[model samples]
Target chain A: MRNLWLFLSKYNAFFFFIIFFSISIVLFVRNNSFQRASVLNSSNQIVGKAYETTNYLKSYLNLAVVNDSLAAENARLRGEMKSAFYSDSIVKREIVDTIQHQQYSYIVGEVVNNSIHHKDNTITINRGRKHGIKKGMGVISPTGVVGLVLNVSDNYSTVQSLLHSDTRISACIKENNAFGSLTWGEENYDPMVALLKDIPNHVKVTKGQHIITSGYSTRFPKGIAIGRVRRTGVKGGESFLNIEVQLSTDFSTLQYVYVVNNLLAAEQEQVEAIQPAK
Target chain B: MIRIIINNLIRFVVLVFIQVFLLKNIGYYNLATPFLYILFVLLLPFETPNILLFVLSFLLGLTIDTFYDTLGINAAATCVLAFVRIIFINLTVQRQGLETEPEPKLGIMGFRWFFFYTLILTLFHHLTLFLLETFTFSDIKYTLIRVVLSSIFTIVLVLLSEFIFFRKKER
Candidate 1:
């Protein structure tokens, strides 16, 4: 017993290291999993508050750029307004029915902290549970798709940015509607680029073609702009095309974003979960 | 002793803030990110208990991870760094020679020794961090690029900070 105690005491540092390392690995694995919200993330109250404070101070430096983007968005929105369009058709019918139900809503949020460098980048937004933010909800910028909410606290949330290695958004080519999953951190490490995989080689892929969300998932609405195709190629013995895309949202300048709240998500999930008898 | 504790505490806070707020946003083409927080762990007093060193390293890593939104990756890497630190110090730094210099500061350890130490430790930390982050051998080449680039970035920043801040040993 004495020898055992002595042995343990002798190697106590190694034991301690093992313990700490195991704890860290456990935390890493647990938190990195999908849809699981852990307390150690940036969404924690104190950490979130600290980031919020610093972001508030730092936000002033990017005011001009933010204003420019906001102005551009406003102009785009203005052009889509009814007043901006000239009615050429004389025949007009006012048929208002309850056929179209609200499927999605947007909750505006300011990005408190964001990164594109790391293999799995994340963004922290100022809005959270109190502002209708939740895990698995889709987030979008004024320009295009941004990310999906991974965790949400009382007043803050962490978004799994599109640049994350695990992030896969169902996207389709606008020209031919050849749907595939969009992913980052694969072959290319560039923040401005991503890969569109699972696209069959038979599809006609051209440079500069637009890629938008397929709306196959409940997270995002259909037809949200994702990116533009930079190039496409089929690797030897591979059935899928190796297509590169230039992301529309400038993640470096990301400030304001909208957290999509799918009102019909619960219903969709419920319907999808219904098992058919074999 | 109290002075040492207070100084290290201040350093901990300052390093964490600088790393997360200032250096976090500065990366070259999503490749190199300078993790200045590891300096706190590397600069701990030589006489610090091995257990305490590991604990402090883990805490420092966890704090940085909280802000970076990488829950345990930094912590895991820093733990490995702390372990390596113990082994490296045991192998390189003689026990009896500790009277002249209390800690492994750039000013006390001189340029060559400190440079090698920082380079080796930073490389180990970055390699572990990037490997664990990607968790796949498929992108080994890209990950290596990131590891080397980030290690250089971190080593340069660490050396620069050590030179600027730490004073020469007062004989």
Candidate 2:
């Protein structure tokens, strides 16, 4: 009896650790994907509000830089507005097409917290659920795609920066219109990589070719600036383009960003749900 | 006692705020982002209940995971680290036993002992975390590199944080 008591006392802590760990693992594994998704949604909401408040305080400090970018964007927009006029039916059709392609809404935010050095980094902004910010909303600066909304609270939202390994954005070449997946190279902050598939050797590519989203995904709209090709090469048994892109945004000094909301996103997703899996 | 509890609570809030707000964002290199949140875990009362310690560590990790969207990776790592912390503290100081003083801090303990203590524990924390985060040892060489690089960053940031926030007042 004495020996048994000593043995139980010696092993008690280990037993406790094993028991607690097993229970937590069971809970984590049992939830399934949809339940995890919902938890992510709620956490995203709370984090968004917390980040948004922090962003609000930091935006005030970064007003000078933000004002400069806003001015530049405004000037570019005004120039396009002037050139929008045309009497010809072809020109009118082109104008309507441009308008349709340019469909986007921008909500301004500042990076209260930004990290580019880590393998995984999150950027928090000063906008949240109260401002219609939701999980999966794309974050952008005047320069390029920054990240997507992961969590949102009442007044702030956290963005999963493009630098993160988990972040995947659909991209296409401007000249050839070939689609590929863009992801951050874990080592760097700005320059990103794209995995392009099934492109023939005949297609001539050059340095600094513009790359944009393919609009195949609901996360981002077409023609929104992504980056420019930094390097082009062939890989795989068949010919494919391995492109390196220099992101327009300097993530190191990131400040104000726009949280984008697509009003038709939910409806579009619902309609597309019935399609057979490709 | 109430004042002491309030002081600890205030310290917890301040440390977390500074960690998430300022330090998390300031890493100039890929491996430089530090986990200053461990300061809360380190500063907790030595006599804190074992179950309470585990629960608090888990909650702290969950908060960070929520922000970074890394699932339960942080929570799992923190729980393990918290469980091991008591054992390390006991093994190292059991010869002399714990003081009647406040909490663990470098100033309270001598320099070299504290340094080694923090280093060994910090390495353990980072190793478990990165391993869980990666979930594989496919790139064994690269994984080792990350562990070393991230440990240096964690150490520097933690030391700097201790200096800045935990300066010992004249007794």
Candidate 3:
């Protein structure tokens, strides 16, 4: 013990420096911004795998909440099927109803990781190219629009969450068809609110009205609900109504979202390209 | 020994609070701000255990990192500073002073020795920290300016504290 202490005392500075300095360098390279899209990211393979492990351990604790949301979704789906059968009066409810469309298909996936506090927040899902997920695809929960896919690796995909400052989604007022883009305000703090802008002065708007995606770009389908207008305003001399939209998706509680794959996106882009400059 | 531990513990808490709450809010222009928490690493007793110095500086850097959200940057720079500290002491303090003056406060060490010691160490720390923060050679000029200005700013604060607290010899 005396000899060990003597050795450590003699060389402890060099010893400790070597240990801590290597750890710092390891973390430094891992956290470098250029490597953001790699496995070093918060939602990349390494951290995602860790989160999944932890969630697996604690999932039983959250069984009730998970069951409740799943039950609600299942009930909604069953109700819609019943209504469809009754209204159609063609195929009996016994026959399976498959209303699959070629244009847009949803790939359900779990949010392996997510963040909200950063200027540019991102979400990562277990779904990837292996699961027909691709970049620029729109992600939505059962309740509302989640975000657009920013980057995708083989087994994972990162989403540009709505909480990000630069995330702009095309939105339209449900009551009046007044279209605008939704953006997170400069101050992205508690109770995250998106600013809906560019609706002309002529269109009537009101608080608590539903705003939804316009399907302008092939990212989101038309009428995918986004948020409700919380506060309304007018910027200086601009002939547009400036409004704050309280996003319906409570990002903190988000667990699962469906990645929207627009199979016809390429065709749409090609068709739009042929149009001469107006 | 206990008194030394108590004093250092108190200084750690006070300097961290001052750096995070007070000095952090005093950003006059966009570019440069003083980092007073380096004073904790600077003023540690000369004869403190090498392991303790390393650990203390690591914790101090991590605390500042928590405030700035520049994770790993401060910790690495501060670790470098702490590693270089023993060499700095060897270079600056005379053998007689090391024996007589355990704690090399400016009042005891006299103005010139104190200035040179603080200036060089502070510059080394600021250079490492700002370089890590930028981590790019393209803005070398801007980074150098930041290093120089912030080092001077931190030095001034350290000297001010030394004069305020240690001027009277508590015989």
Candidate 4:
């Protein structure tokens, strides 16, 4: 008994280490497939709002630049509005109807931290659980889709920027309705790439053709302007067309984003989830 | 003991802040964010309890994984390093009977020995981490490149930090 007790005591630390290691492995394995919820999510609404305040403070530092851009946008919009009114009466009617049939309300916030450099670039916004921000909501700037909200806290939320390695936006060509996944390349931010697989070589793709979100996903509503095609060509031996798109939003300088609150998103998801099994 | 604990805690906060705030965003030239947090594991006092060391290492890795949204990669790498630490130390150092404690900072070992020691261990840590991250051998070339790039950056940063922190004292 004395010998056994001595042996046990001698190796107690090693045993404890093994036990703790096992516990950590088990915990990690169990949570491997964990999805984000409001509670565990980093972008919880309360934190989102707090970050929004911080973002507002940050914007104060760039007020002059923002004002200049806003003025430029105003001029561009006015010019487009005048030409668009005379170009087509049908387009004007559709625009009016779209305004009337707006699907969801928006909660405006400013992006406090934005990065275009990293492969998994994320944007931090000031808005959170207090503002009813939730995970998987779509975020957009005036130009186009910015990203999707991944995590939320009480006063801050983190967005998986469109330039991220994992971002998969549902994009369709405006001219020909050809659809593809718009993804960023590992290279520098010269021209963003899109993988338009299974596109027939015969399809006429032109430079500067507009690309917009397809209504297939709930994260983004249809008709949000994404980007324009800058270049396109057929892969040497593959059936896919390699295309590059210039993003509408300048990720280098981002602020004043709108979080889309899809009021019926939960209901829609529930229905879709059930219908798929049926 | 209190000083050690406080130092480890402070190191933890500083490493994580540098990681998430600065290094994580620096995706220069397709290289990864260098992990210098393992330096804490490498620098623990020689006489520290092994079980406590393991726990501390796991916690450090897990904290990083939480922010990165990666599951188990850093923890697995850190655990492997912690497990092999004693053996590596034994192989590298011939201790006298009178000196019972370990001095973790490379300054104690002289430049050449310290560089070799840090290089081997950092390489091991990076290899395990990047392999786990890629999780396949099909793209071994790319994975190898990443390992090399990350290892180089990690080594440079670790040495730089030592230089900065150890400035006031002698080796």
Candidate 5:
């Protein structure tokens, strides 16, 4: 018994290492699973507050660029206002359109923490559950699609950026309606580029063609710009064309984004659940 | 003894803040990222208990992870680094040397020894970090590039910080 005890004491450091190493590995594996919400994330109060304070300090550095983008977006929005169009009908009649119902709403959120270097990048925003931001909600900047909300606390949320390896957004080529999915962290590690997969070789894809959201899922509205096709190639024995896209939203300078609130999300999910399990 | 504890505690907070706030924003072309927090682990006193060393390293990693939103990756890498540190110190630093130098610092250990130590430890840490982060061999080439580039970046920053802060103490 003494010999056994002495032997165990001699190797206690190795055991401690094994125990701690395994705990870290466990945490890593659990974090990879989609549904599990972790408390040790950036949305925690202290970390979020620290990021918020730092973001406030850094926000001033990009004021000119942010102002320019805001001005451009304001101009585009103003051009679409009812006041910009003139009624051409000889007999003008007021018609109340009752056919269309709003399905998506936008909640403005300021990005406090953003990263593009890692294999799976995450962005932290100021809006959270207190502001109606929830998991799986789509987030987009003024220019293009951003990411999906992965976790939410009272005053902050973390977004799984489109740069993440596992993130896939349903997208289509604007020119030919070639349906495919946009993903990142593939062959090219460039933050500005992503891979558009499942596009059939038969589809006529051209360089500089616009890629937009297909609206197949409830996360985003249809026709939101995603990127421009940079190149297209076909690997041997593969039926799908390897399409490279240059993302529109420059994540390195992302300062603000809008979290999409799908009003009919619950209804759509309830209806989709009616399908029998295969 | 209390002074040592206080110094390390202050270092822990300062390093974590610098890592997540300052260095986090500085990455070159999504290739080179400088992780300066591991300096805390590398500079721990030579006489620190092995168990305490592992615990401190894990905590430092977890703290950085909370801010970075990468839960276990940094923790795992730092744990590996701590283990490597123990073995390296045992092999290179003699028992008699511990009496003269209380810890491994650039000023205390000389430039060449400290540089090699930082280079090897940083390489191991980055390799484990990026490998576990990508978690696949499919894009091994890109992962390798990130590891090599990030290691160099981290080494340069570590050496620079060492010279800037610890150079005066040597004089």
Candidate 6:
């Protein structure tokens, strides 16, 4: 205390000068226009740059969450695609879902067992009654109609493969409605070809024409793509056309299939029973 | 001792009034403010205490600022002047009259010594004040012009007043 007082009294003039000089400076800064403008401008520039950097960092941090939501949304929309159904007449605009009731509801399942190399090939699916799959329900791959469900358990079902000998399906050419009974012979184990019979020889048939299911029975829907016509010939005096078809389903890589849930299958079966033999 | 105090008080008032009301009002040459008030600092007794000298000079410059609406430029310059005035007198005046405190008049301090003293100190005061006011070297030319013109005028005025009034005191 004593030293400080001594110093103050000794350099009292210098201290007083400094005090008064500071006061003058404060007043000058408050009053001067140019100094005020320069101070505010530089300070604002620094603050604005800091805010912009923080905003950039915030957006970068949120990018992962944004990407996750986009992937989930794509998965949801894939389930509602028109090509995944038994009908292609419905166009894929946004949600005209009110017009489509339960004409077809598909139970998606993976093929647990597929035997394409055998003469009596059969497929085992990982879906059954618990998933609304029943006997006589049609199954299909993304590219073509596969077969009908023959038996069911609690959690599994068996489908008669289109590659089997006794299996027969009615098919028609897309261009001309010249339908025939589709069959695979005992020797037809190539897994890529089938035969369409009963097409009249006089009916015009073209190679490379698309063949689709004729919906003659309650088993499958009409217009389900079966395959494409690969070859057509009439033996010397045969009354019917022998047409070879290339199966659209690539059996070697078959993994997923959808089982059709026909809402009126029981009613249609009962109505068919009363028809007399033609 | 009382008479010296009274005389300095009178000189302080007279110089401040003349600087604020008369000299500063006339914008002579647009660059020169004939700051003859520093004459008070020049004429203060050589033996004046350092603290008192600094305070007197600060107050003198602040008084001029209040009139001219300038806040700190004059106060800071005058405070520096007050401090320098003491060292200046000690350097210029001889040790022959060591015991007695002689007034820094043209008669007591020889004219040659006083002229140089006034010229140097006045230039210092003008430099400090103008530098404070501009506060930048970007317009150094303008600062230099203001200091030179104003210092020359202040030096002449300080010499004139000393010759006119202090001559009567010396006689």
* Highest TM-score against the true fold, candidate: 5
Q: Compose the digit string of candidate 6's lDDT tens values, residues A1-278.
A: 99999999877656766775676567556645333322221112332233234434544554675466446646766877965558655574666668766766778876654545434456766676788887778888767788877656666666777976668898889889988888984334467899999999888888889999987776677888898989999968989998999998876456567887877778888997897878
lDDT by residue (A73-120, candidate 1, tens digit) is 999999999889999989987889789988899999999888887778
Looking at chain B only, the TM-scores across the models are 0.98, 0.86, 0.93, 0.90, 0.96, 0.91
- Stretches of candidate 5 off by over 4 Å are A276-278, B167-171
Residue A100 local lDDT, model 5: 90
Candidate 4 lDDT over residue span B1-171, tens digit each: 688789888988888767755676565545555888888888887776777778888888877766555546788778777767756776777767215434667566567776877788888888888777655687778778878888998999999888776632241
Off by over 4 Å in 4: A1-41, A44-99, A112-121, A164-166, A184-194, A262-278, B97-102, B167-171
DockQ sort, best first: 5, 1, 2, 4, 3, 6
lDDT (tens digit, per residue) of candidate 1 on B63-82: 88878777789999999999
Candidate 6 or 4, higher TM-score = 4
Question: For candidate 2 chain A, which ten residues in a row score worst on lDDT?
Answer: A33-42
Give a tens-digit lDDT track for model 5, residues B51-165: 9999999999999888888889999999999988988888899898787788799888889999989999999999999999888898888889999999999999999999898
Error of 6 at B154 (Å): 0.8
Q: Which ten residues in a row are the worst by lDDT in model 4 chain A?
A: A36-45
lDDT values for all models: 0.89, 0.70, 0.77, 0.72, 0.91, 0.72
Q: Number of the top candidate by lDDT?
A: 5
lDDT, candidate 3, A1-278, per-residue tens: 99999998787778898888777667766655544424434345654575566556655766787788788888878877845554646664575548865688889998765555444467778888888887778999887899988767777787888876658899999988889998873533343578888888888788999999998989999988898989887888888888888888887667878999898999999998896878
What is the lDDT, from 0 to 100, of the residue B143 in candidate 2?
62
Candidate 5 lDDT at A149 equals 94
DockQ of predicted model 3: 0.15
Write candidate 6's Cα lDDT for B6-125 as tens digits: 999999999986774456434343356578999998888877887688778877876665444355667778877875676676676677774554687887767898899898889888
Tell how far residue A131 is off in model 3, in angstroms.
Answer: 1.7
In what order do the candidates fall by lDDT, top score first?
Answer: 5, 1, 3, 4, 6, 2
Tell me the native contact fraction for each prediction.
Answer: 0.78, 0.23, 0.30, 0.16, 0.77, 0.18
What is the C-alpha lDDT profile of model 5 across A1-278, one tens digit per residue?
Answer: 99999997787777777888899999989987875547999999888998999999999999999999999999999999998899787897788989998889999999999988777899999999999988999999999999999999999999999999879999998887878899997776788999999999788888999999998889999999999999999989899999999999999999989999999999988898897878
Q: Against the true two-chain complex, what DockQ does each candidate achieve?
A: 0.76, 0.37, 0.15, 0.30, 0.77, 0.07
In Å, residue A245's CA in model 4 sits off its true spot by 2.9
